[model samples]
Target: MPKKGTRIVCFSPKSSSKSNSVTKFSAPSRFGLSPKRPSFSQSVMDRTLELAKPVITKWNPETTTFAKVTSLFHESRGEAKDFIKCVHNLQKAMHLLVTENPTSDNLAVAQNLMQISMRRLQKEFYQILSMNRAHLDPESVSTRSSRTSIQSNSTSDYDDDDEDVDEVRVAGDSIVQVEDESSLAMADLKLIAECMISSGYAKECLKIYKIIRKSIIDEGIFRLGMEKFGSFSSHKNKKKNMDWEVLDMRTKNWLDAVKVAVKTLFNGERILCDHVFAVSESIRESCFTDISKEGALILFGFPEYVVRNSSKKVPPEKVFRMLDMYTAIANYWPEIESIFSFESSLPVKSQAITSLTKISEYVRTALAEFETAIQKDNSKSIVAGGGIHHLTIDSMNYLSLLADYSNILSPILADSPGDLPESSESPAPAISRRFAQLILSLLAKLDGEAKLYRDVSISYLFLANNHQYVVVKVCTSNLKYLLGDDWLSKQEFKVTQFAANYERLAWSHVIESLPENPAAILSPENARECFKRFNASFEQAHRKQSACVVPDCKLRDDIIKVNLLRKVLPVYREFYNKYRAKMGNERSIVRFTPEDVGRYLSDLLFGNVGSRSSSSSNQSSPHSRAPQSKTSF
Candidate 1:
């Protein structure tokens, strides 16, 4: 009925005359009117289309269960299975139609049905993704992926040819089990994905997948409190002006978020993408990159932003947070590398590495700033009683806490040695060397603080107090391990040296006032004068030294007291006993017997002990004269 070269229009069963849906087929050859037997190939092609049409039309997006606002895969597994099987059959029919009967009228019908089927599958894919978001969440999907992998590996000994068939059969059988909804959803998605991709609608399938899954990831990151630092126009201004309390909270949140993002969020997406698009490596990588790359960049980029936007002088406390970020990235590098292994995902990897590099640089800079702070401390107020300087306590506390992170700082300091002095006495790790340098700088600052004291004896006491405190702090904490026993021993010796300096400056004049030889007899006037000089010097030294403090009992008893007793006690005792007899009734002029002198020395340097008043001294020696002049040391 149609002319040569004319086209015959084929419409879907649901199409009306007003519908634009139509497929065109060229008119068959005019010579085909001769009643000839159909070839075996033609019969097979016809049979293929006959078998595929009912399932294809039944599951069509317009007239079938797919049109309803329900997940086809979730509502009925049997129907979902039939739908996938129908698509496979339709693909076979298309292959046969193209090869055996390119111009057959039924070819146009098959083409039309195939398009409808793919649209339905696309809709179902989107619905499953949207409706089961919680089930398909990263944590759930990751767990299912692990379980699926174990099952696959356990049955791998089966023939490779049966693997695909077995996978489909297993997916169907598992749908009836009381499996978790996430596992069912995952298997259904994978099944539909393979079917659509094999049927040449990969673009449509991937588009819907990326749209839905990427949104889920973006929303998940939002819920996890990952902010997009790039959205701000002035990172430097934002960070510089931001309150540290707020920034610290954000940094802590970032730390928590990054772990979830990498280990669970991105990892699950990678698994789901791989499983769904298992037939094509390229598709899997591309899909996963599209779904997770932006979120990952924002997540990892937070640390870099914090570091880069920081004021030129980041607080020393900020270094600890920076180290936290650095340690996080370093600890999870294997996961990051594995998850973002694709070339397309390299930006994410680069962002994480850049964060690490920038954080390390900032940690080094912040530490250098901390050292400079110690070096530049200019407070002039001396600690009363020559106790430890405030600067010493603060610096040592900071260093001891810093030492807690030595495992983290070791590599960082090693990378940029800076101007940190290397110890020639022994080979120390870079962090140890840096710690040693920092402590030395603090000691130098304490030395400068020591000069603020007017009394030379008090200055020596100040140095001794601070140095002993430093040694105690180092020996008690992780610093002891970093700065080895040799260094510790050397520091301990320095403490002793300071203590000795204090002892000598405080008591040398008192010892000198006694006779060179206690047995050397002199004139009675010389005897009275010797007693006068001894009383003047001993009272002056005892009163002044008693006001000073030795906080550490060990240093007081073992070092300062021992050195003083060994140097002053025996000499003073001999002078007192020899002179007490010569002074006669004026023995009270001696003012202190050997017992009194030893007791006073024992009480020296305990800060709590008050100076002996003139009234109390006079009461002890009722007849002793008030000295004609005050002694100076």
Candidate 2:
């Protein structure tokens, strides 16, 4: 008899019955001689049929309950084992009969018996597969594959002694019993499949498997909420009709679906295919490709369809979703390659690569459009006090979020050449160059917006405010990593330069009103005229600056205020003390004491801080003046 799991090839019978050769045999000399003993081939055939017929007949689909709701393996493992053993023996018998009695009546009988046995195994194979749907589901099968590996490795570490064997068996028994049933079902299917394929019934066996399992995979993909993109009528029309909100939701669903499909759905089917057709590499590959190819194509094809069906004028906001899909494919590529490893599965692999390429293209296109949008911004409304522009806020916000995807975008940007210069100092050079270019475009646009301010000083303040806002945004987020310390330091220095320009333009004439040397002892007449010029310049500078605003507290207090005090205060104090006494009765010409100048400077740059009072009291006493005290100056 053939050993279990061995393939037995059936040979075609030779047509010996048609030969014209004649044989003559001498009649036995003794009349009482026993009739010619049965031929060895004849006895072998008789014994093989007797052993195979009863078991094969008992398990016949039409005659037994095995074809009904019962699983042969689950109903009685002994009978199942006996059935498989009989099929193997029947195949062996067929091989021998074909070789020994190629034209005998016994060969025909053995061939017919072999057919009956294979039919029985085929029915059992389909029945077990149908019955064990849940136990053999992809997720469960994937789990089983891992557990099986662990169990096999664990079993190998033990000695072959009976005590060690029993310990291993008991430990196995402690596992979830459902897995054991799944293992038994898989083993039985493998046995039947091997027997049928070895016996030349592979076509029938593969037909049944492909039909049943392919449906399961299709349904599995559908249940996971993957939609068929072809159902949409026209890619362009679909893109125009579908709003961003709907596409966004679908993209999210695809993200979820692809992970499960690769990790559990296609992967599980691959494992099951490899196990059932373990005896044939070609069959395993063919089966897996047939079972998983269509679904995987659809799964991987989703992102490309999304790119096609998205508006050609893709929204800047949608780039992240595109990157998300790209990252998902890139992240799970190894598993996809392993599961669909067959040469026949190249289309599925190609589809995945195409999707990644398409998504990267979409991201690059979206980024280019975003930069163009920033450059072409043409809002006419001026910011009230040369504060941060709305364009600046929006552009910085978009760039900051883009920085969050630096790792994903790095390779994508590297592949697409850009007009921007590369910075080796950056961690992700391609992304950093692109970000810097976009920022430059935004700053250029902001420069135009700053011109809307009537006061040159306020224009400087607007640039300073917006630049400081951009620097802060970069410093606080992932943009810091991509843009690097050098970029940040330069941006910060630009902010300081802007602030200095504002200070010079707004207050230069006021500081210049005082003498280059404040201790110069001018005659009383010259002192009074000097005091008059100094008071006029100081009040004009204060009233104008009071209306302007700075948004950042650190920029307003630490940088702007500190710089103003350092440059203007000490000089005014020395000029005031020497000149106030010389003014004599013309004390009103020294309208602002050194103390009053300090008080007014504190309120500058906070928008409209004292504008109304300064205007109303111009002819009256200076409203910002503290009570006169020689001790205060």
Candidate 3:
């Protein structure tokens, strides 16, 4: 006889006085064979189809049939695998019938049966998955075990000869253990995904991928717990076996859903920015939780199979990649801006900025985490003293990207008064002032970050460079519209001030030795002595200031020299011209003549000291001596 749950398709001989023949169809291996077949009478064939038709029809997606499938396995004293195979047999039998008799009178019956049977196959697969998932949890596993025990005790009511079948079936069920549930679900999901993808349901495949991803991520997050996110994690024992590679691979796989969604949403026609944002939000929520709370820490990176102490902080590469992913999806400002620039695109509601602002907050959090980690590392002597210099480069670039959308970001960053006007009628100048204020606030934060460096001189230099960079970037871009000329003037002035502060901190002694009045002399001897003092001071100042390093060359030439030499050089030249004639043949005592000083001053910054011979190459040209009227800011 066939296995109890195996499907048997029996066919009776055709009419017209033909031989009373019997035909039996069984899927050779997947389906068990019948040892002794009953005579295939017309009534028996009809009864077989009658019994199988309702099973196919009732096993549908309209309702949950997981319990029914579970009951079938228990009632028949068969394994879940056997029950599922029996369901597949029904689908295969109908398929065979359609292929064998496409032109026969029974074609419609065969085709409809095949259609329902295929659907039942899908529904049964999901039912099996659901059933397995139910028992995956510890509490549910205990409950299922108790329930199975009760069912086993009552198996005697079915048949005495079936006790051995029940025992074998129980042993088989035990093999579908808790640890194997996720693997089983993953296998089934891959099959379902292949079917969906081949059938042109890419979005459905993506949905199944999300389910598998979430299960993996939730388990990983639970294992890592809340401590893995910390800079100085204390749960050392708990993290000893933490597998970051596994977490990273799971994250990468989860992120692939985004590609599928983008393809589905944008494959055929022009998609609106609002719709893209909506879908991106859905992906973000599924892939990562709002990690604002303590329990969830973002873990995103390429999978690297290296063993390290788990209590050690999460690597910057992982943290940075996590932010990159967040920026790509959750903070898709570039894509949104590009689409919205087109007049044909639909307008997004202003409220969309609220969600975008939340993403902005995440970016801010990421930057903060990076700064904190760099600072902590520097403090521990594990890193260089001036690490903030490197940290600020990327942080400043990210801030610049964020600042590009100042129209929306200003409202978030600016401190608005409670009695302020409605968003629409607010004056342009007021918004400009708010944006300018926000930029200033961010610049101040950058300054604070730079101070994390132990070297105070390098700290100030860092501030000067980044501040100048931001002011220049803002002034050149569309951001200038919201940060008006006055704001630009103010930021430029601040940059000038920072440059001055840096010089004063490093150059005050160079200035102190200059003669108080070298141009006014009583006699040739006094003029020569005063000129001697002036020459000594100027040469020392030139040498010391030239050696002082400004990391950004353009900023060095532009702001530093524009502000410093505009005040110092003209006075020095006037003193030199007045005294050189008074000294006459002793003029060679002055190391740098007025014209020589002019040429030398330009190259002082580059450290190519005094080698030029052309008078036109003098650094103290009229343009250099006068106030620099056209500041780039």
Candidate 4:
């Protein structure tokens, strides 16, 4: 009031305070621990207390000099006590005001302050009720859920200011009220999904997984990713710009999302299936974006989970596919020599090997393809002709788990005990020979692969020089019919030029153990060795037949020649007729024990000694010369 043009500024009390009351001050911060004034004039203090006296005069103590003491006691207890002298002086003025004059302006100011305090209290209550969690209703949920939905979709990274809004966010309902700020996209949703799974929001993760899976699959991007070969920049149809070849950002997000969710759902595994091939193929393509060591590790996808619902083993096609996935992983991540790196992570090693063990049920294609691919790849590398061994050997690690697979077959056969025909001369005995021959062929092929890996190519001339060198040791505690030296010499293989290397290496040194008729070695001797052991009941019948001494008669030899003709001439009947003699069924084909049978066969066809089969000279397979109907088998 003393300063002529000084403006009076009053700020209302803040909402955060404990109570509402009349507060007077020259400045709003007066009671708020502000710095002290240099010197408050006594006159100013006296005037302010005097000024407050008239306003507080209505409060009475109902005693003598009560009016005079009004300002000291009628005002707030704390303020009056702290400046009791100011209050005492004000009490004198209050007595004068009560007896003489009153200030209407003071009464008006108190009324205005009471109104301000009430309004503040009402506004605070409204806000508090609006945010109370338990107070939310279903209608309110729907109303607010829309807003929350919008916030969740918007990738704003959770601002603290959102907390004010989050309180109003009831699940299951809420309008998506996106503000002017930045928002998230579908791709962002995928990223969020990944984070949730990593941090163990299992429930949230599964929910997000379903959402993204539906989205990506509906968009047809999953199939697209699976089929799209990576490294497109190096492809024959290379796009002019790298951007053109790059996968859509959405595809990438979908993969990261689904992979994380799938991993979490299975505790990080997939059921092995045909789709796993595509999944791996997809992963390989994906890592082409960033082929760092970490990227390479991830590029090799996880083995899909395989479950056997029945007592029956996993199907061959499915098993083959699982093996394919292992091969793909091994081939894709070459920087890590062992993609599994079992030594580094026992859990990973255990899981991977366990996965491989499941594939042990079906061994044929898995073994053959794996063995072939490794040998081919390595040989290419050694000779400096083609691709890297890294590509093939990577596959071999998964394949090698099956080193124990073949033995599984042995027990199954032993437990079931399939009957062997009575004589090598029986029709069923031919079937046994064929089966043994097939096993030999399989061993030979496997040996060829192993030899290629071992770098045993000293020269072309010394091939087939190691036949009896234990190509395979099938241990039924060693009742195994091994590939003896005689078997290798007598039977010329239906070998490819590639396979001929092993044959040559194994057989060149086989002359030392060569028998005149090695085929005879296949049969158990009925003479001194096994008449009693063959079981006297069966042997007596054979002894009465006098089967051992069928000399090389012309008629028998002619019959054998005819049997050979029938074996080889189905496609060449025209040429066989030009030879202008005759052909007939194997007349002696059933006459003797298989041992004598084999002897008669060699002498008749190969001329006594130091000679090869007349039929063996014609070196060609149906594959090389012409196609034939395999239905004949």
Question: Candidate 4 — which residues are off by over 4 angstroms?
Answer: 1-318, 325-357, 360-633
C-alpha positional error of residue 44 in candidate 2 after TM-score superposition, expressed in Å:
4.0
**Count of residue pairs whose backbone atoms collide, per candidate:** 0, 0, 0, 31
Q: Please give, for residues 250-314, the per-residue lDDT of candidate 3 as tens digits.
A: 44653563233223212101121111112233432322221111121122111111122222355
> 1-633 in candidate 1: lDDT tens per residue?
111231222222222255222233356557765345565445555666677777667666667554555556666776667667666655665565456567778767766777777777887888888888887888877755562463343221111434433365466565533336666666667777777777667788899899999998998899888755634454635435556666678899988988888878888888778776766779988899988988888888888777655666556767778888888999999989988988999999998998888887888888888888888777788788898788888888888888888888888889544222344465667888788888888888888888888899889889888899999999889999888887778778888888888878888887788788877877778878888887888878876776788788888886545777766778777776676787888645776666666656776677745344434554333134443333211
Query: What TM-score do all the candidates reach, one by one?
Result: 0.81, 0.84, 0.39, 0.19
Tell me the whole-model lDDT of each prediction, alpha carbons only: 0.73, 0.75, 0.43, 0.29
RMSD of 1: 8.4
- Candidate 1 TM-score, true structure as reference: 0.81
TM-score of candidate 3 against the unseen true structure: 0.39
lDDT of 4 by residue, 1-633 (tens): 011221122223123333223334466565687554422222233354545444333232232364334333123433322232222223333333333324424323333322222222222222222332222211222222232233234332222333222232332134343310011112122222322222223233343233333332223323333323222233445433233113234234434533333232111111110111121323322221121222222222223222111112332233334444444333333323332232333344344445434433334433444344444543432312111223322332332233333234332223221223233333332223333434444344444443343434222211221221222222211213422333433332322232244323422232222222322322332222222222232223222212211122332233234442232223222322322122233222111232332332333312222233343421211112212222221
Q: Compute the lDDT of residue 505 as modeled in candidate 4.
A: 41
RMSD of each: 8.4, 6.7, 19.1, 26.4
Of the candidates numbered 1 and 4, which has the greater lDDT value?
1
The candidate maximizing TM-score is 2
lDDT sort, best first: 2, 1, 3, 4
Top candidate on lDDT is 2
Residue pairs that clash (backbone atoms under 3 angstroms), model 3: none
